[model samples]
Target: MTVPSGIYIRKARIQDVRTIHALLMDCSKQGLLLPRSYNQLYSHLRDFFVLAQDQGAILGCCALSITWDDLAEVRSLAVAPECRGQGWGRRLVEACLSDAITLGIFRIFTLTYQAHFFERLGFQVVSKDNLPQKVWADCLHCPKFPDCDEIAMSIEM
Candidate 1:
C-alpha cells in the first residue's frame, strides 16, 4: 500500500516520545496494545520508527527491539485512529522490519491480538514456548501475565 503524500516513516526522535506515548495510551485504552511508560519509551527510543507528516505530526509508531543474537521483537505498533486504513500501520511495521534487516537480525516476532494483520506481512503463528525465556521478563509486568491471549507470530528474513 502506498503511504499518503506528506506522511513518511523514519527513525523516532526524542521529541517524538510524548506523541508516541499518547498514541499508545489511546490504543491501550481500547485494549489494542499495552501502555509504555515514558522512561521505557525514552530508553528504547532508538528502537522505534514513526510515521509523521512533513509538519511533524506523528501519526503512528512501531519498534524493533533486539532480543538475542539473531532475534528481535516487533513491539509497540500503533496508528492514530484518523490515519487508519491508509496503510500507515503497514508502513510503520515495514520500517521496523527494514531496520531489523539492516541491523543483521533475520528473525522477528510479535505478540499481538492482530494476528491476521501480522500474518499478512508473512509472520507465521508460533507457540509462545518456542520463544526464549528472556521474552517472558516483560510478560511479568503485563497485566495478562500467565494468561496472555496475544498470539505469538514470527517471520524469517
Candidate 2:
C-alpha cells in the first residue's frame, strides 16, 4: 500500500503509548479488537508502529509481536474512524509484515474479527488448533478464552 503524502509510518515512540492505548481502547469498545492496558503497551512498545500525520497526530497503530521462533503475530491494528477507507489500515499491517520479514520471521498470524480485512492482506483462514499451544497463553486472559469467536488467519512469507 502506498502511504499518502504527509502521513508517516514509524516505530512507536515512548510518548506514543497513551495515544496508542486510547486508539486501542476505542477499537476494543467497538469490539473491533481487544483493549490493551498501559502496562502492556509500555512493555511491548517496541513491537508497535503508528501511522500519523507529519505534524505528529496519530491516526492508527499496529503491532508485530514475535510469538515464537520464526513466528509472529500482528495485533492491535486500528485506524481512526474518520480515516477508514484511506488505506491507513493496510499500511499499518504491511508495516508489521515488513518488520516480520526484517526479523527473519516468515510465519505471521492474527486473531481478528476482521478476517476479511486480513484476508485481503494475504492471510488465510486457519484452524486455531494449528497454532502453537504457547499462543494460548494470552487467550487465557481473554474474556472469550474457551469460546473464542475471533478468526485465526495466517500468512507465510
lDDT tens digits, residue span 1-157, model 1: 6556898889999999999999999999998888999999999999999998999999899999888888899999999999987777887889888989999999999999889899889999999987865356577777787888889999999
**Clashing pairs for predicted structure model 2, backbone only:** none
lDDT of 2 by residue, 1-157 (tens): 5657898889999999989999999999999997899999999999999998888889999999888887799999999998899888988899999999999999999999999899899999999887865356688887777788899999999
Candidate 1, residue 23: Cα displacement in angstroms equals: 0.2
Task: Kindly provide the TM-score of model 1 when superposed on the true structure, using C-alpha atoms.
Answer: 0.94
The candidate scoring highest on lDDT is 2
The segments of candidate 2 whose C-alpha lies over 4 angstroms from its true place after superposition are: 1-3
Compared with the true structure, all predictions reach lDDT values of 0.89, 0.90
Alpha-carbon deviation at 81 in model 2, angstroms: 1.1
